[model samples]
Target: MSEATHSFEESFDWVVVGSGAGSFASALVMRAAGHSVLILEKTAFAGGTTAKSGGVMWIPANPFMLAEGEDDTLEKAETYLDALQELDGGAAPGTSRIKRRAYLENGPRAVDFLVAQGVALRRGPDFWPDYYDELPGGCKTSRTVVAEPFDTRQLGEMRKRLRKGFAEFNVLLGDAARMGHMRTNPDAKKMLLRVALRTVRDKLLGRSFTTAGAALQGRMFKAALEKGVEIRFDSAVTELVRGRDETGAERVTGVRVEGARGSGTVGARLGVLVNAGGFGKDQAMRDRYMPGTRAEWSLVPEGDTGDLHREMERIGAQLAQMDQMVGFQTTIAPGTENDYVLPGAQSLTGKPHAILVDQSGQRYMNEGGSYELYCETMLRRNESVPAIPSWAIFDRQFVEKYKVADKFIDKKIPKGWLEAGYLHKADTIEGLAASIGVEPAALGASVARWNGFVHAGHDADFARGERRYDGCHFVGDPYADDPARGTIEKGPFYAVPVVPGDVSTYGGAVTDEWARVLRPDGSVIAGLYATGTSTASVMGNVYAGAGSSIGPSLTFGFIAARHGAGLGNLA
Candidate 1:
C-alpha cells in the first residue's frame, strides 16, 4: 500500500482489474461514455473464473422475459430474494434491503445495456426453475440468461489468449446436463450427436468455438476490443496508490501493477474497478475464512490468490461474509484429482436410484434443488454427523443408466477408482455398507426407507422431488416413472464418496449499493469500486438462483461504471 502521494508512468480514464464477466461490462460502460479504459488480468488468459463457469446470469424481469410475457416483476424479484434472506435467518451482513432492491432494479437495465451494445444474449430453458421456485414470488419458468455460443475465430489473432472453458466443445451448460441421459432419451441423444458433429465440423473447418462462460467472455472480449478498450493479460495490480482529493480526503487514485513489462504505477482519473475474483486458490485464506474446505475442491481456475484482498485490507477496506462460498459439490475419482474437469456430483445425488448418506448410513437432505444449498447442507450436516465425505449409494440400475464422474457406466470400471477406495461395489446393500465402514442394519434400513418412498411416489422425509426445480431433466431421470424417485434395490450396489466443492469463495471487500468499496466506518473509499467475488456478495449467504453471483457481478459493475462517470441512477 502506497501513501496518498504517488506518481504514475501512465494513466487511463478507468482502470479495471480482472477480465471476468463484470470487468468487461464495466470497461464497456466507460468506453461507451467516451472514457479511455484499461483492463488488467493476472493470468495469461483474459477471463477470470467466469471463463470456466456456466456463464448464466440470474437476472429477474430481463428483456427476454418481458418479451416472452413471462411473469416477473421488480416487486416479485424483491419478494423472492427477501424470502431467501428470511430462510437464511435474516439478511446477511453483506446484503440489505437497499442492496437487494438495487440489484433487482438494475439487473434488467444492465442486460438491456449489454444488448444495446449488440452482445448476444438469450434466456435459459423455460423449464429451468428457480432453486426455490415454490417460495412466494419465485418464478417457476426461470429467470436465468446466458450468452450465445461464440466463435473464437472472431477474436482473430488474440483467440489464443482467451481462456478456454472446462469443456472444449460447444455445448450449452444446460444441454450438457441432459447429455448425460443420452442412452435413454432420444432428444438427448440427438443433442449429443449435434454437439459431436459441431465439434468435428469446427475442427475440420479450422474454426474455434466455445460455449458456457467462455462463450460469454468471448463475446464480451470481442465487444470490448471493437470498442477500443485495451486489455492486458498477465498484468496484476499489486498495490493501490492512494492520494488526497480536492477536499483533502484520501482516495485511491492509481494502481501499481506488475506484469511481463515489469512494475509501474498507472493512474486512474475516474476510478479503479476491482473484479479480481475470490481467493478460492488461496489455501491460507480458505483456512482462515472457510476452515473445513480445501482449495483444491474449487472449480475456479488458477490465479484467484488474495493479493487485492490483503491490499484492500491494508488500506482499511471492510471485508464481510468471508466464511461464505459458492458451493458446487464434486466427487474425487481416482486420477481425476488434478484434472481440469472433475466430474460434478450435484445432479447425480438427485437423480433417481441414488441417495446420499453420512458415515452412519442415514439420509439427511433433499438431494435436489440448489447445488449451493446441497453442498451447504453437507457441510452443516458434518457438524454433527461425519459427513464431510458423504457417500452416494446407488445400484446397478443407476450405474447402467446414469453417469458417474462424467463417464458412462460400463463393464470396465476404473481399477484405480476401486483400488484407491474412491469407489466401492458390492452385490448387496449390506456388503456395500460394510465396505464403506457403515453398519449393515443402518444402511439397510435407510435403503429400505428410500425404496418405500419410491414405491409411494413421494419423498416423505425431505421432499426431494416436490419442488418444481427438483423434477425431470434438471436433476431427475426423465425415463423414470417417477422422474425424481426410484428404488435402489437392484443387486450389485455401488457407493462413491462426495465432497463439497465450489466454483469460488463468495465473500470479500464490502461495498454499497452503488458498488463503492466502503470502510468499516461506513464511509466510501473514493475512486475505488468492486464487483464480482472480489467484494462480499450482495446476495449475502444465499445463492438466489443460477448465475446469482454472475448477475450481481455484471449488474454492479455496470452500476459502478455509470456512477463513477457521474451518471446517476441509470436503472
Candidate 2:
C-alpha cells in the first residue's frame, strides 16, 4: 500500500527494516505469531531489487519436490555445497558452516511455512537444472520454486506504488521470456498456445498478472498487510539506537530514521531486522571493495545504498565475505532518461552461433556456461589478460532465430544503438574484429576452432554443450545437426562489448544460524538480525540453485522471527 510516513511511538514489539523478501518474511512471520510489527522502507516504493528479479528460490528438498516425486535430500544438499566449497572455494574469507547448514535445513521449511500462510508459490519447471548440474549434490531437474503470477490490480491503488521493473526486464514474463520466439516459430505451437491461454485468463478475470519479480514481491506485500503489519515508507533508518535492556544488558533497542519532516526514533521491543538491499549504486563502496564492478553496470534498486552496513558497522557487526557478489555480463542500450535495455546472461551468450572472446581474441571460457561461472573465469583472466569488456561474436543467422531476452531485436539494429557503437556491424569476422579492436587472425582462428568443435558435436576446450544445463535453455535450430553447437559461418558479424558485470551484491555483516548479527569474536549482538543483502549470505559465493540468495534470505528471516517471538527453532 501507499503508506504515508508518519511519526510513530517510541516502541513496537518488533521493527523490520527494508521491505524485500527477507524483511517482509520476518515481519509477517512475527505478526502471524501475534506481534505488533513495524516495517521501515527507505524508499517510497516497495519490492527493492527483488521486484525486478525472477522470483524463484533454490529449495534443496522442498515439499514441492517431494510432492512431485523428485528425490532431494538435505544430505545431498550438503554434499552439493561441499562440492562448491571444494571446487570453486565457495566459502567466503571467514565463512560459517553452521549458517550454511542452517540455510539448507530451513530454506525449504521456510518456503513451506510461507506457502501455508498464503504465498502462492509452486515448483518451477521440473526440467530446470541447477547452474552446476554435474556437481555431487546437484539435481538434474532443479528444485527451485517460483512465485505464481499475481495480479497487481488486487492491490488497487498500491499498484502505482511499486518500483518500476527494469526496462530491460519489465515485460510480462520478464526474466528470459521468449514471447517473440513462440509467436513466430512454428515448432513452438504448444508454448504459444499456453501463453495465449494465460493472457486470455488474465483478461477474463479483469486483472493483469505480474510474473517473475512482481509476483513474488506482490504476494509478500499482501501477506504483510493481511496480518496487520504496519509498513512505513520513505522512512530511511540512519542509525541503530543502542540502549540498556531492563536486565542492564546493552542491546539494540531501535533505530534512528530521517522522516519526511524530521529525524525520529522507532523502538523495537524484541529486535530490529535489517534485510535491506545491497550497495549497488554506492560508488564509494564499489570503488573501495569491488573496484572492478562498475556502478553503471549494477542492476540493484535505486534505494540500495548500504544503510544497514553503515549503521551496523557502528555496532561492531563483523562484515566478511565482501569479495563475493552476484553479476553477469551484459551489453546495455539507452532506453528512457535513466533506464536502459539489455540482454540477460543466458539469453544470447548461451545460444548457438556465439563465441565470447577476450581482447586477445581467445575464448576464455565456455560461452554457454552459467553467467556466474563464466564471469568468474573472466575475473581471473582480467589479472593477466584484457578480459574486461569482452566481446560476443555472432552472425545474422542467430539474430534472425532469436533475440536476447527480447531486448536486442532482429533483422535490423536500432539506429541509436548503431550510431552509439553499442552494436558493431561488419560483413566479415576480420572486419568485425578490427572494428571492435581485436586481432583479426585470432578471431578467425577462434571461430574456426568453434566450428570444428561443433562439427565433432563436442567442445574439447571448455565442454560447452556437454551438460544438461547447456542444452536446457537452447532454442533448437531445425537445420543444425547439433542444436547447441552451430558454426558462425553466416556473414554480417556483430559484436557487443561485455564487462565483468555483477547483477547484485552478496556478503554483508556476518550472522549466525539464528540470523543474529555476530561480532568478530563470534558473539551475538543481542536483539539484532540481518538477512537478504544486509548480511553476509549463507551460501557465500555459490549460487547453489536458481533461488540460492532468496532461499537463505527468507529462511534466515524465518529463523530470526521465530527465535525473537519466543518460539524455539522454526527450522
Q: Give lDDT per model, in order.
A: 0.88, 0.76
Compose the digit string of candidate 1's lDDT tens values, residues 179-261. Answer: 76786676887888899899999889987778888899999999999999998888989998899777787899989999987
Clashes of each: 1, 4
Could you give the C-alpha RMSD of every candidate to the true structure, in order shown? 1.8, 4.0
Please give me the total number of clashing residue pairs in predicted model 2: 4
Query: Best TM-score goes to which candidate?
Result: 1
| Per-residue lDDT of 102 in model 2 | 81
Residue pairs with backbone atoms closer than 3 Å in model 1 (clashes)? 4-242
lDDT of 2 by residue, 7-32 (tens): 33567888988888888888888988
TM-score of each: 0.97, 0.92
Candidate 2: RMSD to truth? 4.0
